[model samples]
Target: MTQAFEGIRIVDFSQVLAGPFASGQLAMLGADVIKVEQPGVGDQMRTTMANNKLADLKLSPGFMGVNANKRAITVDLKHPDAKEIIHRLLADADVLLENFKAGVIKRLGYDYDAVRAVKPDIIYCSVSGYGQQGPMAGKAAYDGAIQAVSGMMGITGTPESGPMRAGYMPADISTGITAAFAISSALFRRTHTGEGQHLDVSMLDSAMTIMSPNLNKYLATREEPALVGNTSPTFQGTANTWPTKDGHMQVSVITDRMTATLVQALGKPEWADDPRFTTSQGRVEHADEVKALIGDVLAAETTAHWIERLGNEGIPTAPVNSLKQLMEFPQLEHRGILATVPAPPGVEGELTMTGAGFHASNGEPKVTSAGPRLGQHTEEVLAELGYDAAAIQAFRDNDVI
Candidate 1:
């Protein structure tokens, strides 16, 4: 079976998580993504997690996690001759992706105008901290900084501890998803119009977009949303994590039937008719009392017992799992959500990583190649652009590859 994006070609100049992640998704969808890196040093992520104590330097787990199904080529864009090589690759590329700071590409003389001059149908995407323009346009920002700036930190933690950043790089991941959508949309438009466009994706813009609903609610109601720990505000009284004899379990008693079942399951049917907890609204008004009552009942059972009992009753519930437990989850395995792919050449088998997240009904997504090592395909990619062996050797001799 043919892949979804088999004929698409992407020239990727993205480095870290966000840009690379977007391009990686495209690669998973069958785009031939050629990741261009600086000579020798390569993507900063290659060495970011390389510690003396770790076994493999090139196979850093962090590096392997984000990059897959792409080829790598090294070119010193700063070198005048190398610019021609990049132009050669862009001449046939359907998309160009980069995450450099504002004006860096323009300085390198491969800005959208220059690239479009070579391939007018190229979908050029630029990812950055801020956007291409604004007061903070040139300022550098990362996931943590964007999280703080976008007010995501303010709503994360518990009320007692005050605001806190999320445990993961939500800003980066969210921005990457936005970039992927924008690139796909641009590709679709190109199919019809045969015109390419410049797409700008900013960490700040993506973070703010994710936070808009909460910010809008606060602005409209003049009511600040409090940090409610694990439970959502709308479902405060009915939703909570309770401790069992063995472990913890989260339970959601969203409907009357579920609430009734939970009350019966806990052997506290008397509480069902109590005026203070009869309705969801009434329970919210007396959330503290309801929580204390439920907590007392749950403290008597083990997590496994509660899961078996509550699940049988049709109440939505689950045990909080650690990363290791989640990875080994049976459901994920059954769904084929996790599978290992071979490591790139020169990398060890111990360096293998998980495949893409999406699944296709028509055909399995191919993992044809692993993330490229620094400058691994420099000569090969240039050769594809019609350069002979002598020209590539000369460029390498000049420290331009």
Candidate 2:
């Protein structure tokens, strides 16, 4: 079966995380994505987290993680001849993705209006720190900056440890996923209206959306959220992370039924109906006592023991796995969230990266090609665009491509 974006063509003029990640998702769904990068530098992520070996190869593992299934080409957007090449590429393009700060694209002469002039129905999606129009529109932002500004940091961590950002790039990845959805929606709308529109996605906005529950709670109650940190929202001490003999286990035994099952698992079924620990209100009032009791019992057993016993007893429980432990998890293997593709040229062995988060009936997400080498398909793509060999040579001589 054909993939969802089988015949769509995307001109991806983005770098780092958000823009490339959004285009990468569509590329996985069979869109033909042409990654436009600076001639020598390429994407900054090509060296992010790279050692000497991968850096010299210009194929950082981090870069490949988000950039699967796309072709690479080099272009100097400031060059005079660059506009001609871009116009040629956009003549038949279905989407144009960029992540430049606000007004940067206009300075480069490829703003939505200029691009729409070439492809009337092109989906022009721009990912930025704030948005296309705002007081901070032109501000440069990184994942950590966005996480702090979007109040994500404020809501994370414990009271003692204070506000802290997540270990990973939550803002970058969230914005990428959000931008992909917006672009997909724009494409769908174009099918009906036969018109194109500009999409302005903000990393700050996306981060706030990811923290919607906390934001909504604060808005409705006029109270800031407390940094509970590994504690369930129920505020029940039984529904928090507890240290076991071997590792940590997170349990969410909030409801009366689940609490009863948990008490049985701990060999204290009598506590399930005890007046001081029976109701949700009572548990909250005696949270410290409940936490001490549960912690003492859990400390005597291994995390594996609790996982098996509580899981079988229908109490929501899981081990707080490390990244290494998580990779060995059997459930992930069954779910197939990770995808393995052949390594890019000059690299040995296969490369495994994340695939689509969900599955589909027929046209499931796929990675047909590994991420490309820098400007790996420049000549091939230009030739496909009907540029003759000498004309392509002239472009190279003039530093245009």
Which lDDT values do the candidates have, in the order given? Answer: 0.82, 0.90
Off-target runs (Cα >4 Å) in candidate 1 are 50-56, 350-352
Per-residue CA lDDT of candidate 2, range 148-202, in tens?
Answer: 9999988888999999889999999999999999999999999999999999999
lDDT tens digits by residue: candidate 1, 1-401: 88767889999998878998888777877888898888877787886666753224454566656677788888888999988898889888999999988988899998999999899888999999999998888788889999998889888888798889988789998998899999999999988998999999999989988888888888899898888777655655768877878778898776666777888888888978986567777777887788888888888988878888888888899987778877766788666645466676666574435666777788577555566677777878889999899998999899999
Model 2 worst lDDT run, 10 consecutive residues: 275-284
Per-candidate RMSD, Å: 2.0, 1.2
Clashing pairs in 1: none
**What lDDT would candidate 1 get against the real structure?**
0.82
| TM-score versus the correct structure, for each prediction | 0.94, 0.97
Task: Give the CA lDDT, 0 to 100, for residue 61 in model 1.
Answer: 60
